[model samples]
Target: MVSFTELNQQNDTITELSNVLCHLIDERSVCDLKVTCDLFFSYVDQVKEHLDLEERELYQSMLLHSDQNIRNTANKFLSGSGEIKRVFGQYLKRWSKNKELRINDHDQFVKDTREMFQLVFNRIEDEVEHLYPTVRAVQAAMPK
Candidate 1:
């Protein structure tokens, strides 16, 4: 039973974290520069929390409100989550195998990760800007 204000705050926090993580992909050392190690972990944690909440609340709400065609499109976006999970597993495997990746290899890692991040980020932005607005309208229409 989260309030709308709380949900909005969570959305804002998630967007801010995603933007920071995008920048960090270009410069991992930036995490060290401006944030405490604990804060870096917090950012990671928040991103995960945001994703979970989006799947549970926002996406569900959107699906409940959308027509079939739009719901199918949202399904396509979700299929990309499998790709994200595969890439994440690959990253873990690579890390485990090497113990530490070379600095040069980090470029390739960033390239792959950036592609995956963009897919998720774009879907999130689309849902936030378009689909969620429809959901809000649906909420407004309902008896309260």
Candidate 2:
């Protein structure tokens, strides 16, 4: 099982990344925009990879190999996450074409982007708060 400290560290890293993304969009620095976009995309990919392992491996194991109640709860949580994931895809599309966007489009994009960040932050916090504790509990029960 992963340690709580490790999970907390990951949470902090993600928060920092999200903050930087928000700052980039708000500042709209044409100079470093390309570099920022590349970095943001790389960070997003890494974060998604980490989440995939959690959802597919950890969540799957919990749902299939654990109690029915836990599975049911996890499913409920997953429904909310699915909505957030859809929003995230939209947010990514907006960011990818950000350079091509007109000045008039910038305000709306920034607004939407901020909302996206909030959604992501809330979803991640919820998952880490709820899912990790359950994962730790289940891990404790299993024999090495």
Candidate 3:
């Protein structure tokens, strides 16, 4: 299992990357910079990777734990994870293609991008407030 510190760090990094992305978008209505597009693609990949690790190293065990509350929490997270993944996929399809972003509607793109980042931020906050405590309690109760 990964330590809570590492998990927290991953969340921080994810948040930082999203913030950078938000800034890049906010500074310019045009999404024509190669660097900006690169970072945007990279941000999506990093977020997906972090989520994969989080699910594997943290949530899976909780799903099968002896406690009902833990199982319920895990189920909720899993459901949320699916929804996030689905929405992100749709967003990518709309804005990006072949490693490039074609933002035909700049204003709408900015709005959607911010909304996506907000969703990511909300998920991280939710994990910190609910998921981590439950996982820590489960680990503490286990025979170390």
Clashing residue pair totals per candidate (backbone < 3 A):
0, 0, 0
Against the hidden reference, what TM-scores do the models get? 0.57, 0.77, 0.93
Model 1 misplacement above 4 A: 1-8, 18-43, 59-104
**What is the C-alpha lDDT profile of model 1 across 21-138, one tens digit per residue?**
6677577555344353344345445555655565566556445544775566445545544555566556546532333333346577577656655655675576567655655665
Clashing pairs in 2: none
Off by over 4 Å in 2: 1-7, 30-32, 97-104
Candidate 3: 10-residue stretch with minimal lDDT? 23-32
- Global lDDT of each candidate: 0.55, 0.67, 0.87
The Cα error of candidate 3 at residue 128, in Å, is 0.7
Point to the candidate with the largest lDDT: 3
List all candidate RMSDs to the true structure: 4.7, 3.1, 1.4
Q: Rank the candidate models, highest lDDT first.
A: 3, 2, 1
lDDT of 3 by residue, 64-110 (tens): 79999999999898888888999999999999899999888888999
TM-score of 1: 0.57
lDDT of 2 at 9: 71
